[model samples]
Target: MPRRYLFYVEQNYCYGILRPIQNVLRSRGDEVAWLPVGDAFDRGGFEAGERVFDHVREAIAWSPCAVMVPGNFVPGFIPGIKVMVTHGLISEKRRKKDGVIYSFIERGLFDLYITHGPNTTTRWRQMADEAGYFEVAECGWPKLDPLFDGSLRRNASAGPVIYFASTFSPRLAAAPRLFDTVARLVAERDWQWRIQFHPKMPAAVTDRYRALSGDRLRVVDGHDTLQLLLDADVMLCDTSSIISEFALLQKPVVTYRNLSPRPYMIDVREPSAVGPALARALQRPPEVMRAVAEHARETHPWTDGRSSERVIEATDRLVESGLGHLRPKPRNRIRHWKMRRALRYYRLFPTR
Candidate 1:
């Protein structure tokens, strides 16, 4: 029997994470559609022939069997088994006080949490056992299927290409502090610089970087972030989860004051140090490259590009087995009320 699935998106970058899975779903004659939750998502990013319902009510009417979410939360009222396909791999983005990573937090909004690697699987399995309301399964992230399948190409550029990215958070973001340094480097080096910021990055900061766009430096909207990860020779980033993606490609990454600096990254302290760190990254030191390989092993062991297939299989099996073992999810009345008000969806028994 064919299954209907909904890809619930709330951010510009979530498209990359969900699209590959859509391809798998369609190839198997299953139905899939996207639902851009709010204004935060860019409608322009939607491709031709992709089905999207403008309202949450219509999505409820569609009767999807599964809802794949890349962002934090989705209305529990929506039909189907809610699956959390996280937006990014783990990185240094963490709480300043206790060094707790945000991605590990369970929002109680999902029935299934897809694990990209063993570390995540172990942690979430423990959480699942404790919560008794969700399930954790290991199936590599679908976003990198193209990357590992040997489909993406390293775009031809005259000099080494450097991808510069930053988290949107004011405290963790490196763009604000390194803007002048980046400008000077763009002026000095022939190195091709590609800047892609988190979707929520303030316009003032993005605008300054966009102004630097020209022959050598261009600001990418990050819809094609995975492509940038494939093409760039070195990644210059700060605390953003993108660091893990770039490093998974076995490329050198230059991180600025990363909370947890790993052997794979060239961690720098100041703006003045970015250039030298980038230089070192470009060199691709044997030790760092070796660490990069090991990092890939630990993060996502599957390079077969069949993670999408695995994810679908796991989801189907779970559905067939039923949710009998797991306990009921908490009502979360307050959160559900907030979601209903925000989306203006007051329908109680949403068109079963």
Candidate 2:
């Protein structure tokens, strides 16, 4: 019998992380349904196996065997087992009061955690030991499989493609501070520029970059950035995990005032230094490539592209062994209220 699975998509852009797993499950005769948690489906225009439901009530009624999410919160009231697959590589960006990479695990909301590498798996195992609620699986990230499998590769003749990406946070974002400098560099060098923003980035910030788009520069709003990563020759970013992702490609990366500095990347304190740093990176590929290799090994250990298969196998073993049937942790009223408010603001659930 095929196990029925529910995949929650809180952001349309999360498809990049969840799609590979979904495809693997389906190929093995499991049924997967995509549940759009907010206005993400409408904005992202995602198509899936069944009718998309905007309300949690409808999803809970379906009684799936397991529910998988890439985001932080999942409704505990639902009978299905809640599985958390990370939305991105664990960057050094802090999102919690304790300076943790994310707030997802602190609440004990998930039954299973699918981690990207040993670094993340070790942290998650420590958390699981403390919480005594979730199980941890160290499957490599599913999204990067294409890059390793040769299905995706950079166009060598793409005319010096420069990818500029930013996080949504005001404190760490380079888009607001470096757009003009980037625009000038693109025009001056006649380089092909690709600018991509985080889905949560403020409309005003995206608008500013969109205005810089021209014959040489393209402003991309797609949910999946893997293609963009494969297309670019060099990457310009702030504190985004895209820096880690691009570094895995063994390419030069320039960071403008990065909140967290790594030995592998060229960090510039001022926007004026971006062009010079990019020039140095391009001119000195051997030095940068060595650093890129070290960064890639430390961040992601698996480059064989079998992460999605490992994830599916882990999920299947848990389900078949009935370990996924463990009761969800007791609900926290305060957290539920906050989540409801956020959903209502996004028009995903009713106000009442």
Candidate 3:
């Protein structure tokens, strides 16, 4: 029998991580089903619900393994082998205002935490240890598909681009500050810049960027970020895993997390210590291209772009082992309650 998966996807936002994994899983003969938390969140008009928790519980009961994308409503009651493949392994340097809802997940509910690099695993392990549970692994970043192959290409327009691939967080104030500076710096230049904001970010910020609309300063929404990075001449970001993709392209990438903690992440080969060393790289990025190249190799020792293969291998191993005991369920039932609900939906909404 083929392997079955009940994957939880929080729509729009987790496309980068979930989409690639879905393709790989299906290609490997796994029957995959999606429970879109994004759709659920929207349906509730952004309000929280027990339905979200109930859906996750159902998915876990049906499949031996369930991948829960972070930022969705996590299952508080289910204590199965909840595996977390982080959307992007980011540093705590730039804290979001909403103290990571899932931070407390370390409390004995999860079994494995897959991370892109050792640095991230180390940090999370400490957090998990503090929470009294410790099981973390470095499986590399599976979503960085473009980096593994030279499949992505630059845009047809051939216009110079400044890609803004970051979500606005108050902790990393340097990011917005640098963005404004770059906007002012490039406002007069002949080149064009595109700003891509995080989905949850308020429209007001995007509107502020739009006001600076010189032919060069353009505010855009919903562009394929991977394609944008591939096409752009230079990328300016802060502590976002997008840099890992940029490293694979071997492009000129400058980071703006100067005020944040020494960002320990995957593919950040070079030490981003402050003063002349960091400033010079930002000012003249091409000059440090060689250093970035050398450091990327050291930082991502296994990052030859075969993350998808590794993930595939890991899943295959799980299947072979008959899936470590299914995510826990209420003892009285054979089939999970959510599966029953989903069947009802299929029967009623069959054509629609």
Candidate 4:
């Protein structure tokens, strides 16, 4: 019998993160479905033939064997081995009402942590020891698999393409700060420009970029950012995780006052210096290229496009071991209440 699985897309970026894994699942003759969790996500991100549930009842009745999440939380009432694949591999901090939280922090919502690389694997392994209920495996990120698989690449552009993406956080966003500089650079250089902002980016900022779009330049607001990264010769970003993703492609990235400028990145504090920094990155100097290689090795050493397969393997191994040995997860009353309220599932007991 074909096993069933669910891809829990809490955010639009989750589409990119989980699609590769979904491919592996379907290839193995396993069934997969989607449960999108928020209104913030764009429905256009879904492609035809991809099965999506309209509500929590649809998911519950299907009773998938596993649920892969790219975001932090999942409804425990959903039947599955809750797998946390995480949203991004960046070391950025997210500020919450309580305090600053890193991605590794446990939210008592998952049974497995599919880590991207050695750095994340090590941290998640340590966390697993304390958590007791979850297991951690260092299966490289599935999201980057398409970049390796040659299935996602676009045709080479007529001109050198520069891809620009920015975070939405006011304190860290460069879109607002470098808008004029980017506009000027676009005018000065004949190079093609592709700009994409974080989904949370203000409409005002996006409107400004949209107004500037033309034949050679575009403000990409869809879910095909991986395609944009492949098309670009160099990436221009703020402190967004796209910087890390682009660098992993063994390309150069120029940032505006990056919070932690890696050697692989050409960082500039002043918007005026943006042009020169971009010029340097475009040159692909030996040092910058070497640093980009090193950064990729440290973060995600798998460029072979087999991470999705490995994720499947890891899940199979965990299932073989069974869940009886693991400790029980906490009740998490308030969190479960919120999920039930939003997803509207209030069954007294989990069916699976």
Local distance difference test scores for all models: 0.87, 0.78, 0.52, 0.85
Residues 139-233 of candidate 3 have per-residue lDDT tens digits of: 67666676456666657644566665665665543334554565555644455677777665666666777778777766666624677766666
Better of 3 and 4 by lDDT: 4
How many clashes in each candidate?
Answer: 0, 0, 3, 0
Q: Could you tell me the lDDT of residue 145 within candidate 2?
A: 84
Candidate 2 Cα errors over 4 Å, as ranges: 40-44, 48-51, 103-105, 156-158, 200-204, 324-330, 337-352
Report the lDDT tens digits of candidate 2 across residue range 41-139: 553466645446666666677778888888888866555667887888877777667766662346767778888876677878897777666788988
Residue 315 C-alpha lDDT in model 4: 84
CA deviation > 4 Å runs, candidate 3: 38-61, 68-73, 76-80, 92-107, 121-135, 156-159, 174-183, 238-245, 261-287, 302-304, 319-352
TM-score of each: 0.94, 0.88, 0.67, 0.94
Q: lDDT score, residue 242, model 1?
A: 80
Query: Which scores higher on lDDT, 2 or 4?
Result: 4
Kindly indicate the candidate among 3 and 4 with the higher TM-score. Answer: 4
